[model samples]
Target: MAKSNILARTGNEAMAEAMRQVNPDVVAAYPITPATEIVQIFASFVADGLVDTEFVPVESEHSAMSACIGAASAGGRVMTGTSSQGLALMAEMLYIAAGLRLPIVLSDVNRALSSPINIHCDHSDTMMVRDSGWIQIFSENAQEAYDNMVQAVKIAEAVKLPVVVTTDGFIISHGMERIEILDDAEVKKFIGDYKPEHYLLNFEKPITVGALDLTDYYFEHKRQEIEAMKASTPVIIAVGSEFGKKTGRSYGLFEKYKMEDAEAVMIAMGSTAGTAKVKIDELRAKGLKAGLLKPRVFRPFPKEEIADALKGAKAVAVMDRSDSMNAQEGPLCLEVKAALYDKAANKPVLNYVYGLGGREIKPEDIGTVFDDLFEASKGKEKPGVSYLGVRE
Candidate 1:
C-alpha cells in the first residue's frame, strides 16, 4: 500500500475533508477558534460545489447547534463544530440531538471552558457535556482528527447517536502535520451512504419525532439509549477495521502501547496521551515498566476492554485533560476506578490532572508526571491526583 502525500494540513483542514467525505446534506455552524476552520473549509466546499450540502451561517454557536438538531431531526445528514464556551452554548441542544437520535457529527475542537478565560485546549469543554448521550472520539493528531470524523459520521449514523470528533484546540488543530486524506471513491465504497432510521423530513412516511414521552416510556427510551451505546462498542471496532481495510489506516477505541508486559501503566485520552507515549518510551529505555492506555471512545467508556488491558499492571495512572469542579474524582478517573473496583488482585490507580486551560504539555512534562506516579508506586512519596502544568 503506497502512502501518497494527501496534503499536509492542520487538524481543522483535515476535518474539512471529513465533512467533505461524509457529504452531509447540511453543514451549519458559527465560527469559533480552533473549531472554526472546519466550517470555513467546508463552507468553501459548499460554494464550489465540492460538497452538495447546505451551509447555514448562523448568529451564534447555539444557533449552529440548533440548526443541526433541526436539520438532523428533519433527517438530513448534519455536521457542525464548536469549542470552549461555544460548545457550552450548544450544551442544551446537544442532548436534544442525541435523545431525538439525530445522528449529527460535530467537531468539538477541545478548548478550555472559561472564567479566567483562555484560547487553548482542555477536556473540560467536552467533559462538561459527558452525559449528553454523545459518543466522543478523541484524536491524537491531525490524521486521527480527519480519519475519526469520517468514522464518526458512519458510527453516529449507525447507532442513531451524535458523535464529536475531538482534539486539543491549538495543539492539534493549529499545528501543521502531514496526513494522507482518504479519497472519495475509497471512503464512499467503505462508509457507504447515510440512511436515517428515523428521519423527520421523510415525506412518504411522515411520523412524529420529539413527541414528549411520558414518564411511563421516557425511562425505557433512555434505557434503550444505554443499550444503543453498548452496541456501539463492537460496531465502532468492526467499522473501524473496515475503514482500515479501505484506507490502510487501522484504529482501535483505545490505542494500546507496550502493555503486553507492563507492570505499571498510564491511561489517558485525546491529544496529550500522544505525548505521554513518548514519555513511556523514555521510561522503558530506563528499564521502567511504563505503558500508556489512550482511550479513543470516551463516551461508552469501553469498560471491559480497559479492565482487560490493565489486567497485569501493579499500578495504573489516569491522566485527565479536564478537571471536574468539586467532584471527588475526575470523570474519566472515576470511571477507571469503578471499572477495576470489582476485580481482585488489582493495582492501585493514580490520576494526574494536567493540561487545563490550554497549558503547554511538553513531552518531558508528561515524563515528569509519570515519574511522580511511578515514584508513588515505589514509595518515593507523592501520590494521588496531581495537577500538572499548573502554578501553585
Candidate 2:
C-alpha cells in the first residue's frame, strides 16, 4: 500500500483537499449551505496559487454548471460543487452535460429540498437527479467522501460521462473525522492527464455538440447515452479496484457487513449506513442473524449483485432518507423491490423513510427496523412502507 497522510477533516474539507490534489483545469461553482465550504476552500487554493486552476464564481448554480459544461466541452478537466436548491437549479444543465458526454465531477452534498424551507442532510437532492445519467456514489463518512472524490475523476474520464460524489449535508459535511489522504504526486499520477478523443476545441476534428435532434436522431442519441451509462459500471469497478490497490481501503458497488447467512438485513445508503453497521454489530452479539447492505454506487443500481447478496435473507428493510412524495415507497426501496421481483427467494422487503431534514437516526432506531424485519420474516406482519423518527 502507498503511504498516506492521516488528517482530521470535515467531509467538505476532505473533498476540497482531493480537488486540490487533482488540480483540474477549471472549476466553476456557486456557494450553498453545507456544500459551500468545498468550493470556498478550492477558491482559496486558486487564489493562493496552490493550484493552477481557473475559478469561476458564477451567479447561480445553473451558471456554474453551464460554465463547467463549456469548459469541459472545450477539452478541459472541470469540476464543481453544490447542494439541494443549487442542484435543483442546475437540473436542466445536468442532463445536457451528461448527454454531451463530458467528464465533469460534481461534489453533491445531500440536503432536503424546500417547501418547508429546511436546509439539512437528506437524499432528496440527489434522488431528483438519479435518472439524469450521472454516476452517483454515496459516501458514509469523510474518508469515503474524500476517496470517492478522487476516484470520481478517474471514473468520469474513463466513461466519458459525469459523476456525482455525494455525502449527507450537515451530517457528513460538517462532521469531523479522521481520514487518510494519498500523497499529492500519487493522486496526480493515478488520475493521470485527461485527453479527450472528441471535444469542441479540437481544431483537427471540429464537431457540433448539443445540437437539437428533433425526431429520428433523438431516440438513437438517447439510446447511446444509456449504453454509456451501462458502460460506466465496469469503469467504476476498475477504478475502485485500482484505488484499493494503492490504498488499503477497498470499495465495491455495495458493502455487505456480516451478511453471510444473515436471516434479516437492512439496506441503506449515505451516513445512515454507518449507524446501521453499529446496530448490526449489536444485534449480532445478541445471536441475531442480522446484517447491513450499504450501497456505495446508487446509479446502475447493482441489481444482480444486490439480489445475490440478499438471497439468503428471509426479510429485508430498505432505509431511505428521502421520500419520493409519490405516496408510495422511496427511490431506493422501489429499486430494491424491482431487483428482487423475479427472484426465487421472494423474501419480504419493507421500506422505512427516515432522517429527512437532518432528523437524528440513532442506533436504537436502526435496531427497531431490524426487529421489524425479523418479525416480518416470521410472517407476523406484511412488508410495507413506514416512517421512522417521525410524528404521524
Give me the candidate number with maximum TM-score: 2
TM-score of each: 0.96, 0.99
* lDDT on C-alpha atoms for all candidate structures: 0.84, 0.94
Tell me, by lDDT, which candidate is best: 2
Per residue, candidate 2 scores C-alpha lDDT tens digits across 144-226 of: 99999999999999988899999999899999999999999999999999999998889999999888899979989889989
**Total clashing pairs for each candidate:** 0, 0
TM-score, candidate 2, is 0.99
Clashes of 2: 0
Off by over 4 Å in 1: 1-5, 379-381
